[model samples]
Target: MPIVQCVPNFSEGRDLEKIEKIVQPLRCKEGVKLLNYEGDKNYNRLVVTVIGEPKKVKDAVLESIGVAAELIDMNNHKGQHPRFGATDVCPFIPIKDMTMDDAINLARELGKEVSERYGIPVFLYENAATKPERENLATVRKGEYEGLDEKFSDSNWAPDFGEAKKHSTAGAIAIGARRPLIAYNINLDTKNIEIASKIAKTIRHSSGGYRFIKAGAVEVSERNMTQVTMNLTDYTKTSMYRAFEAVKMEARRYGVNVMGSEIVGICPMEALIDVSAYYLGLENFDLSNVLETNLME
Candidate 1:
């Protein structure tokens, strides 16, 4: 059995009714397990994690994407996170008995079908990108939804799937195949968004930070604080502890203290173990030393 993990992010997060409706398709589906789903009202985004046989997982994701398109109108959506579609980005990761090429093919198939079914222009990103420039998701989403009209008009910006035009309501989406990523956020005590943005620019890969980090800043109005949100693209290379420590170091420079930190969805157990080793000053500690890890096997 070829197992794959699919993480799909949608643009609506505040409405419980809509969120449940969108998630209903993946529930109790044979050969697919919905691992977790998280909604951040501040970001107005929903992140769902599911793992299963590749084909079954793809079908479940496709069904949920349809629900999102029917219910969410990108024109009326507002949030701190950058987005360009009702179903923003769907990524497939090969988990077991599979290869990168298999995931890439799954991404392409889903992207094509999504375009055909919903009339949403799709961009293939990460390992599934057809062009080098489209490989980085941030580069592809630079203009966002508001700038999609201008972006679509540009010859070089033609989508890999669908017509060279934006969806009337849902906007566009990016689908791809990639390694596991950790959606991590570090909050600062200060409400100053400029400080957070500066820290984000300093730490993200494109801005000369960690090679596997993709980061940005967002203000959590409800919490009266700002956050340095990140996607730790490759946790083995750039551990959560490293990113958290970097943020703490940067915050100190501005006389801003670290408020707290959070992981949006499920993260690898090894990522947390790395953090434990650093904070506890444990020498030569690893997952092998954890009791639960041994029991789970």
Candidate 2:
């Protein structure tokens, strides 16, 4: 069991005691398996999921990003998802026989040990991109954290480690190594929200649409509704029943419909066995010939 799955995206989901003091260092880490959580107080963010081993899940996500860089300030952050840090966007996913160059060398050894142990400024996207325009984690979180102090005090976005700018309270972190991404969401019976923000710009992928999806559309205010959220990344190149039927066919052009769909954390088992083999034409299905998953080993 090589499994190294992490999915941390935290920007303090509406402060439940500051998200339990930023997940109390992964609840005092052991073999790290706190798998599943999804706050979303209107995208005040918190996506947490975990797994183990690759050095005990990278020492419990670098000690929960040093306790979310000592209780997450991100200069009085607000959120609608797009965040630069307060431990935002860590990735690392390799499941079993681990490789993606062993999660890109454990994401550059957890982004250079979270930029030399908490000075905070990491940014190493997609297969731990050292460059190539940072293999896009929203173009390395464009203009976020109030445009990140003139974008990392200019070394062409300086961070591959702590501070060429912003971390006065955990503001810049985005480590990587990829694959295994799911975080879905749907919700839409309509309260408009600009028809869920134009069906998240017609099914996200840098606004041209669907290429392993990556949407937006939000508004939940205690469920008044209007979402579309996504990440999907590869799900074997866009599956999850083709991203919930492509946002239920873009929420039926304004007459909206889909009111249930979510899965923010812990998603593996071939993403619910590839949506029950694309809605049940199960044919040659074989998950070790499933009999309660090989009857407890």
Please give, for residues 1-297, the per-residue lDDT of candidate 2 as tens digits: 787888888888877887776666666467777777667777788888888888888877788778877887888878777897888888888887888889989988888888887778888898889898998888889888888888877788888876687877777888888888778888888767888878877877777887888887878877678888887888877787887887788788767899788787777676688788778888888788767778746
Distance (Å) between predicted and true CA of 98, model 2?
12
TM-score of each: 0.95, 0.34
Number of the predicted model whose TM-score against the real structure is largest: 1
Kindly report which residue stretches of model 1 are placed more than 4 angstroms away from their true locations once superposed.
Answer: 288-297
After superposing all C-alphas onto the true structure, candidate 1 shows an RMSD in angstroms of 1.6
Question: What's the true lDDT of residue 232 in model 2?
Answer: 82
Model 1 pairs in collision: none
Worst 10 residues of 1 by lDDT: 264-273
Error of 1 at 106 (Å): 0.7
